[model samples]
Target: AQASFSQVFMGVAFTCGAEEEVIPFFDRGLPVEYELTRSIRVVAKTNRKKIGVLNTEAKLFGGFDFQSMRSTPPWPVVDELKKQYDVEQVSASEPIEEEYDALLIALPSSLPQKEMDHLQDYMEAGNPTLLLVDPLTIINVGLSPSEKAGANMNPFMRNQGPPPKEKGDIHALMTALGVSWNKAQIIWDQYNPHPDFAHLQPEIVFVGANNPEAFNQEHTASAGLQELVLLFPGSLRKAADSDYDFQPLVKTTPASGSLNYSQLVQRSFFGVQLVQPRFGHRPNPAAYTMAAHIKGESFPDTTNGADSDTTQTPTRVNAMVIADLDFISQQFFQIRQQAVGNLNFDNVTFFLNCMDVLVGDESFITLRKKRVRHRTLETIEEKKREFREEQLKEEQEAEAEASQALAEAQKRLSEKVAEVRQRTDLDDRTKEIMARNLQEAEQRKLDALKNKIEAKKEARIQRSKEEMEAKIRSIQSNIKVYSVFLPPLPVLGFGIFIFVRRYKREKEGAAAARRLRA
Candidate 1:
C-alpha cells in the first residue's frame, strides 16, 4: 500500500517543480528504486526598498515629536514602515542618495535653502517624495517669556498662528504642484464629525473616502480608506495655471469653508478658550482639498550631451502633499484608539499607502486596504427637497381652511335653532324637542364635515404615494426589460432573416435548375 501511494504521489509531483524523491522500504524487503531528479533551489528575498526620512530634528508645530518618545517605542507607523522597507534617518544638509527609493518630510519646522535645492534636484530626477506639512504653526505659551522665545516656555497657553515662509518650502513646492495652501484659513465641516471632538467643531473634520464630493475614488491612495480625522487642517486650492495633473485624494464636505482662526479665538475670564463667530459676512461654503496627488514632468531635461539641444527629455515626477500633518501624529493616534475594537480611523493606513505609492511599492497597498462598515447614503436632489416643502405647506393651508368652514357651519346651525325656539305657536315640549333635534342635526353635520376633510386629505396623500411608487416601478421595469430582452432581439431577428433568405435562395436555385434541364 505504501509503495502504491508513493507511486501516485510521484505522478502528481512530476507535474509540479518537485525534485528528487526517495522511497524507503522495510529492511526485509528487496532494494527499492525511486527516480532522482534535479533538486530545486529556493531563493530568499533580500532586496528591501530604502526609505529616507528627511529632517528628523525639525520641531513639530504642536509640540509633538516626529520620532518616538524616550521610553516608548518609536511611533507605530515608523516601526510598521521599517518592517516592510529599509528605513534610514537622513539629514536635509546631505544630498539624497540614489539608493533611496523615496523621501519623507514630516512636519518640519524649517527647511534651509540648501536642503530645498537638494530635494528639487532629487525630485527632478524622476524620483517620488511625500510632504506632510501644516500650514499654521502651533505655539503654547503660558507666560510672557514663552512669547519672546517662541518655544514652549509655559505649558498652559495654546496659541496658533501662521508659520513664517522661511520655516519650510511648503508654499514653493505647493505652488509648483499647482496647489495653494492658505495657513490663515482652517477648513471645517458640520456634517461629518468625530464623536469625542464634537466641541471643536470644524477644527476637527472627519472625512471618508466614500464621500464622493470630498474624496477621489479613482485614486488608489484614497480608494478603500474609511475615514481620516484632520486636526486644524488648512485649506488647499488648485492653482489656475498648474502644469501638473492634480487629483484630490481627500477633501472637506460641502458644508466646509475657510474660517479665520486668528479672529475666532478669544480667552474667557476663567482662562478657557472660546471660538467666537464672525459677526458680519461669512465665507462661501464648499469642498476643500486636504490632500492631493500631483504628477507631471519635473523639469525640462537640458543635459543629454549633444542630443540635449535637439530633444528635451522630461522625467515624470510624482508627489503627494497633505495640508495637515497632525492627523498621523502619535498623539492623535493615541487619542483615536478604541478601548475595545479595531482602530476606528484609517490614518496610518493612508499614510503607509501614500508612502508605498510614492516609492512605487504598490504591492503593499492590497494588505492595508479594508472594507469600512459605516457608509454614508447618497444625497437627494434640491428639487425633491423643495417639492416636499411645498407639499407640507399646502397640507397645512388645507387644514386651516377646513377648520374655518366647520366653525361657520356650526354658527349658522346654532342661529337657526334659536330662531325656531322663539316661535310662539309651538307648545313647550314640542319646542324643547325641536331644539334638541336641531342640536343633534348640527352635531351630525359637523361630524360629517370632519370625516369628509379627513377622507380628502388621506386620499390625496395615498394618491401621491401611489404615483411615486408607480414611477419607481416603471423605471425599474424599463431597466429590467432592457437588460434581459433588448440585447437578444436584434440577434433573433437577424437569425430569422438569414433563414428566410437561405430558403428563398434554395427554392429559386432548384426552380432555375429544373427549368434549364427542361
Candidate 2:
C-alpha cells in the first residue's frame, strides 16, 4: 500500500496485489517478484454487511441541500461502501431504528447531547462504531482564499473576523468507550510532506504520512497500509479511568507535535528548521496516536434511561477511532480534473480494511493484510551518493593544482624574458622576437596544461561511474545467486545425507538376515 501519486495497484482480487510503480525506463509495469505479481480470485457473497452513517453534514450519503435548493451528489466513500455493505443514513436526533453490523460517526463531537444519547443506546445494544474525529474541518470548502480568510494576502481592511473553527471533543463518549481526543490542537507530523502549498508558503495545516513506520504492523486494520493525508488531525489517548485496551493503529512520528491554534498561526513554526529542540519547546515532539482501536465492554453509565436492554448482557464493542475526518472527504483524497476513482493517498483502502475487519470478513482481512517484503537497493544508492561527493572533491583538487602549475610556469617565463632583455650580445629586434617566441611557447604550455586538467576530470568522473555500476552489478548478481540458487543447496545436501543413511541401514539388515539363515 506504500504508493506514490503515480502508482496504482494491480491484482486479481482487490487486496491481493501490492502497489506497483510504473517505471518510465521500462515503459511498462514495474518488474516485481513472483509473489508480488501473484493474485487470488474473489467470489462475491450475497449476504453483504450493513453500515450506518450518522452525520448528514459530511454529505457522505447525498441529500438535498436546503440552502442550494438542490440535491447534492453522494460522496465516493458511500459508493465504495455500498458495494460491500448496505449503507443508510441514520438520524442523530432519533433513536437508531435498527441494529447494523457497524456504524460510522464522523465528527462525533459535533452532535448534540440528545443525539449522543441515541448513539450510546445503539452502541450499548452491541453495535460497533467507526468514530472519525477531526480538529479543524474546512467550514467552507472549495472557496477561494478571499472567501475563506475574508481577504486576499494584502493583510488590510479585513472587516469580518475569521470563521469559527470546528473541533471534535467527545469527553463523555470517549470515557465510556476508551480514549480521549484533544480536539483543541491539531497534530503536526513532519514525518511526511504535503507537496502542495509549498510555493505559497502558507501555514502547514496539512499533514501527511506515507511511511511504513506510521502504521502499526501488529494491528490487522492498519497493517500493510502506508499512506494517509490529514488536515488538522487530533491526538487519541487512553482515558485515565477507562479499563479498555486503547491500542494505537496509526501514530504521528516523534518529530511531530500537538500544535495549538497559536502555534499554527505562528510563522516561526513552519518550514524546515536547522535546529529543532524537543526539550523546552512550547510543544515537544512526540509519537501521538492519530488512529486507534479500543476494545472493552461498553460502560453502563451512558446506557442508563435508554430503551436498550442493559440487563441482558454487557455490550462488548471493538471500535476504531480516527483523529481526522478530512481523509475520508473527497477534496482531500481525490485528484481534481482526473478520473473520479483516482486517489492521492491510501486512506480509502485503510478505511475499507477497517470496515471489513469490523464486519468480521475474515477472508477479506487475510488478503488485505498479506504483506510481501522487498528490497530498495539501498547499497547501490548509497554507493552512488558516496562516489558523487568523492568525484566532485577530486575535480576541485585537480583544477586547483593545474591553476598553481600554470601560475609557476608563467612566473618562470617572465624571468626568462627579463634575462633575455638584459643580454648585451643580442639586438633589440632579436630580443623582441625572442620574447614573443617565449610568450607563444608559454601560451602553448598553458593550453596543454588546461586540456590535460579537463581531460583528467572527465576521465575520473567516467571511471567513478563505471566502478559504481560494476559494484551495483556485482551486488545484483549476488542477490540473484542467493535468491535463485542458494536456497536449494541446503535441500540437496540434506537429500544426500538421507540417502547415505538409508543405504547403510539396508546393508546392515541384509547382512543380519544372511547370518541368521547360516
Candidate 3:
C-alpha cells in the first residue's frame, strides 16, 4: 500500500512539473533535495517526543475536515519537532496522555467547555499547551435556544453567547494563564492606499507587544515573532489578576477603532447605513492589541475526577485569538489575487509563521520570500536598499585594501631612504652632490605616497557621489515608468487579467464545439 501510494504521488508530482522549464527545475530541485536531506538528519538527532494536536471531528464541525481545516498545516514543523520530539494528534473526544510534554489545541470554538476544563489539571501541572481560539465562536454550556439555530450558528452562539456581553466564559480558563480573549476587538490598517483596496476595503495588519517575564527570548515559539495575522477579529489581552506574564502577538491599527459588539453584527434595512465604521468618521494611525502569550502559572484544578489528588504545579500556556472569522475563508485567498501591491498570500504567510513558532521550527520563516511588486516607486526603493548594502561592503573592502597598500609602500620607502643615507665613500663635494640628488629622490617618493593617500580619499568621495546620483536617477526612472502607465500598475494588471480570462473562456468553448463535431 505504501509503495502504491508513493507511485501515485510521484506521478502527480511529475505531471505538475511537466510544463516547467527543465534547467530551472533542476536548479531549484537540487537545492530542495539537499535541504530535505539535512532536515532528515536533524530529525534523526532528536529523541522522539509526543506533540498532541487537538482538533474537532467532522460531526462536531458540520462535516469539516479537521486535518485539512487550518489555513496552513503545522505538520511540517511538527514532523521536524518529532525528530527531536514525539508528535501526536489528539482529537477533542480523545483522552490526553499524562506522559505527553506539550499539547497543541487547534480547533473551533464549538469544542465542549468540559474538554478545556479537563485539561486544566495537566496545564497547572507545568505541561505546555498551545491554544488556537477559532475566529469568533467558542465552546460553552451557556448557549441559548435562539443561538443554537443550526450547525452554522451552533458554535458561534455556544462559544460567544448572546448580545451586550460579548466576552465569553473562556476567560475563566485563560485568566489562569494571564491571558484573556478580547471578544469585541478587530485589527484594521487605515493607511492602505493601494488602488485595489483603496475603493474596496481596508486591510487589517496586527501587531505584537512584549511581556518581559513570561515571554523572553528563551522560549523558541515566541522567539522573533513581531506580529501575528488576525485569523479572527477577536484578540487576546493580559488579564489583571493573573500572576503569569502576558505578551501581545497580534494588534490593531491606531485608527480610532473599537470593540463595540453592536457594530460587529449590524442589522441593515433597505440601503441606509446602520452601524458607523469601526475606525470612526476620521482616520488614525496606531496599532491596537490582539493576540497574546502567557508563559507561567496556567491553572489550579478543582475537578471532581479521580486525578484530583495530583499535586499543583505552575505550568505554562500559549494562546492566540483573532476576532474576525472570515479572514481564513477561501474567498479571501481567491480575491487576494485582485488586490493591489501584490498583496496575495500575505495573510497566508502570517498564519504559517504562527504555526512555525508554535511547533518550534524556523524553516517556514526562512523559506518564504517577501513579494515585491513591479511598480516603479517600489523598484526604486528596492534598488536603494540593495545599493546601500553593496556600498557599505565595498567601502569596508576598500578601506582594508588602502591600509595594506599604504603599509607596503611605507616599508619600501623606509628601506630605500636608509640605503641612500649609508653611502659615505665619496669626497665631500661628491658626497654633497649625491646627498642633494638623494634628497630630491626621497622628496619625490614622499610626494608619491601623499598623492596615493589623497587619491584613495578622493576615490571614496567620488564613489559616494556616484551612488547618490544613481539613487536619484533610479527614482526618476521609476517615476517615468509608472507615469507612462497613468493611474497604477494594479489597474493595468487587472485589465490584462480580465482580457486573458475572456480569451481563455472563448477558446475553451470553441474547442468543446469542435470535439462534439468530431
Candidate 4:
C-alpha cells in the first residue's frame, strides 16, 4: 500500500566521502549506485521493499539523534533519496549485518581501524565489500619520508633505510586480501591533470593502460571504469601468481615508467631540493602498480577464540590500490572543468559499482529508474524555462514592431492631409469637403489598423495558451506512472459492458423511429 504513494524516502549517512559521492551519482543520472542504510526506512509494498539506513556519524556532530541534526546537515543526496526510500540514522560503530539486503561502505581514510577489521569479517562471509585505499593517506597513516626514500636517488641525503615495518604491515594486510599498496611514488600521468596543475612540469610518470584486456571484464568492480591514474615509482605490483584468476583492472600506458621515490617526494610535497639535470635515463616504459581482484583465500585468523564452531569462509575479495592518495583530496574534486583528461569519477564509480554488487537487485533497479526519470525531468524543466524567456522576448519585440508600424502609418496620413490643404487646383468648397472626407477616412483607417494589431495580440495570447497546455500535457504524460489502482481490470470491463448495452438501446430506438415514419 505504501508503494501506491508515489514517493521514495532516503536517509543519507554523511559520514564518509565514498558515500557522499555514491549518493549524488545515483540521485541524479550517471553510472553509479545508490545506498540504503538502517537509518532511513523506505515504505515498500509487495514488490517494493523499504531500504533501512544508518547514519554512522550523525551522533558525533549532534546528540545521539538524527532528527536534531537535520537543520545543518549537508547530505542533500540522502534527502533526495528519502523521497523514494525510507531513511534511518544509526551509529557508525553498529554492524549492519542483516538490517538490509545490501550494503554500501564509503569509509574514507579517517574510519577507525577496528571498524575496518569488522568490515573485513563481513566481506569474508561472502558479503560484497568495496575497498578504496588511497596511496597518500589511509585512516590518517601515510607513508613517512623515511619509508619512501630508498638508496636509488636520495639527493637531499634524507635518511634512508629499509622501508618501515608499518609499510610492510600495510602490505601484508592488503596481500592477505589480494590487494597491496606501495607508497613510494605519485601517479603522474601525461594525459590527466587538474587544470591548474597541468601547466606545471610533471616529473613522476604514471600511466593507465590503453588496452581493454588490462582490466578484468568479468568482474563487477571494473565495469564502466575506463582509466586509472598511478604514480611512477614504488608502485604496488600483482603479487599473486599468474594461475590466480584475479585480473588487472587498470594499468599505465607504454610511454610511462616509475620514478624513484626521492624525486617524486621532492617535487610534490617539498620544493625543489635538487637543481641538476632536467632529464634522466628512463627505466622500463611501464610498470604494473595497481591491480584489482586477485582470487585467493582469506588470511588465517590467529585470534584465541575458544568457540570450536567458528570457521572462516573462502570468498572472492575485491581490492584496489593506487600509488598516490592525494588524488582523493578536495583539491582534485575541484578540477571538473580545468582537467584535460579523466577525473576521479572513474575510480569512484569502480568502487561504487562493486558495492552495488553487494546490494539487492531490486534496490539497484529502483535507483536506476529513479535517476533516469529525475534527471530527464530536470533537463526538460531547464529547457522549458529557456523557451519561456525566449517567447517573452519575442512578444515584446512584436509589440514594439506594431507600435512602430502604427507611428509610420500615422505620419504618412498626416502628410497627405497637409498636401490636400495646400493644393490650389480645387475650389474652396471642394477642397474643404475633400479635406474633411480624407480626414475621416484616415481616422477610420487608423482605427482599423489598431483593430488588426489587437487581433494579432489576441492570436498570440491564444497561441501561448495552447502551447502551455500542450507542454502541461507532455509533462503529465511523462509523470503518468503505472499502477493497479488506476482503473482496475474488472472496473474497466464493467464500463465496456455498460457502453455496449447503451449502444444497443440507441440502435433499437432508431429502428422504432424508422418504423413510425414508414
How do the residues 236-325 of candidate 4 rate in per-residue lDDT, one tens digit apiece? 555563222456656554333444445534443332233322223233446354545544454344367645466754454533333343
By lDDT, who's the top model here? 2
What TM-score against the true fold does each predicted structure earn? 0.53, 0.52, 0.46, 0.39
lDDT of residue 327 for candidate 4: 34
What does the lDDT read for residue 368 in candidate 1? 57
lDDT per residue as tens, model 2, 360-468: 8745555543433434456654554455345445544655666677788778878988998888999999999998898888778878876786677567656764775
lDDT of 1 at 155: 27
The lDDT of each candidate is 0.60, 0.61, 0.47, 0.45
Tens-place lDDT per residue, model 3, 179-246, is 66554443344323232433433334433322122122443434444323343255456677677766
- lDDT string, candidate 1, 1-518, tens digits: 35543433322122223332222221211111211111111112346688877753333222242122223335545654665677877776767775688878765434656676677667666678887756433322111110112232222332444432233454675575567776556666644433345355556778865456666778888887777877767776777666677888897755455666555454443332335554211224457888988788644434655565575666565778887766776754454433123446777768888998888868656655644466432322232223333444454455566667778888888898898899999998999999999889888988898789767766765565456446545655766778899899999999999999999999999999999999
Cα deviation at 43, candidate 4, in Å, is 9.6
- The per-residue C-alpha lDDT of model 4 at residue 267 equals 43
As for TM-score, the candidate ahead, 2 or 3, is 2
For residue 240, what is the lDDT in candidate 4? 63
Clashing pairs in 2: none
Residue runs of model 1 more than 4 Å from their true location after superposition: 1-44, 56-73, 137-169, 193-197, 264-283, 298-316, 335-343, 375-518
Q: Per-prediction count of colliding residue pairs? A: 1, 0, 23, 40
Deviation in Å, model 2, residue 206 alpha carbon: 9.3
Error of 4 at 306 (Å): 16
